[model samples]
Target: MRRAIDWAFRDRRTGAITVAQWPNLPLWLFAGTSLADWILNPPGTVAWALRLIAGASLAWWAIDELLRGVNPWRRFLGAAALAGQALVLATAGP
Candidate 1:
């Protein structure tokens, strides 16, 4: 059990357990755009643009992590995030 846990969560480069990491560039962009969308509440076109940018940034981050994450745990998080985003988009009103 412990070996399996380590196999999934251990950081390849650092050789330490890694469950979380600081926000990377795309994640930072996503946060900034999302915050702007929520707090500024711009008019229709600007709001839509912000939402698009935020979603693209999040998707880029997720894809990056899924393809090149340091550990299985990170990859799983990326896959889950992408799946969640897909679900939201699928169900969102036009």
Candidate 2:
């Protein structure tokens, strides 16, 4: 049974399947909780934190795409927007 479970999870293409997909439940829970809190209180600190995180993630993804040599202009615009959002979050006071 254990071997079967492991085989099922093992990535056939790269042979490097991650168990993090299941173990990051707590992270997803925290994200959901923060989203709910932001929905209930729009201009709260938690909302700003979430915004900052999202902006950073966006910028990171944009940079990654650009590094792959895909759509320079699109990535630049996306990174710029994300940086602006991060700046807004930074300037927002608690």
Candidate 3:
């Protein structure tokens, strides 16, 4: 778990621990926070924003995956995740 967090939160471009170089940190952080919010809190603005950002980012990633994905399953999963996120974003929160 520690290794996973370090790998995910690390600065990919610089191979260092810095705020400026984390490309996917926001996405990961939003996902984590969203999950926690789902468990502990009611839907609200934070949930909306988190889903909106995560959905939009994943949608864009799906587009890229469709174009140049490494494998068939990954592309399929990306598209599916984007769809699921979009659905949740649209229907969730107030």
Candidate 4:
């Protein structure tokens, strides 16, 4: 158990503790907020569907980052998508 835990959370090269295995927190936050808005306010069916798709896409990106690897371009793209989603939600105004 200890060995498995160490392998999962520790950097093999430096032997230091790392949170590198976890997904991007900001991505999770944005998705969570978008989902909450959909649940609480219930936008028009079309808007709600769009929001759901965007949120799911962000989640897929997060999982991809974890499973594949992190890259600066991925971070930038995710942030841009989050911003776009926020803008759309704001302008639409539930």
User: What is the clash count of model 4?
Assistant: 0
Instruction: Report the candidate with higher TM-score, 3 versus 4.
Output: 3
Cα displacement (Å) at residue 56, model 4: 3.0
* Model 3 CA lDDT for position 90: 82
Off by over 4 Å in 1: none
Query: Model 3, clash count?
Result: 0
TM-score to native of every candidate shown:
0.91, 0.35, 0.44, 0.38
lDDT of 3 by residue, 1-94 (tens): 9676555445444555432323354446556656766786756777667656656666666566545444444455557766776787688766
lDDT of 4 by residue, 1-94 (tens): 9776666556545676665445465456656667667677665885666566656667566455444433444444546665665676678755
The Cα local distance difference test for each model comes to 0.94, 0.53, 0.58, 0.58
Model 4: per-residue Cα lDDT at residue 46: 59
Candidate with best lDDT:
1
Rank order by TM-score, top first? Answer: 1, 3, 4, 2
Assess the local accuracy of residue 50 in candidate 2 as a C-alpha lDDT between 0 and 100: 70
Q: Pairs clashing in candidate 4?
A: none
- Root mean square deviation (Cα) for candidate 1: 1.2
lDDT of 4 at 61: 67
For model 3, state the Cα shift of residue 69 in Å.
1.1
Query: Stretches of candidate 3 above 4 Å error?
Result: 1-30, 39-43, 85-94
> Model 2 over residues 1-94: C-alpha lDDT tens digits?
9666546455444566433234233335446655765677766677667755655555555455335322334344546655775687789786
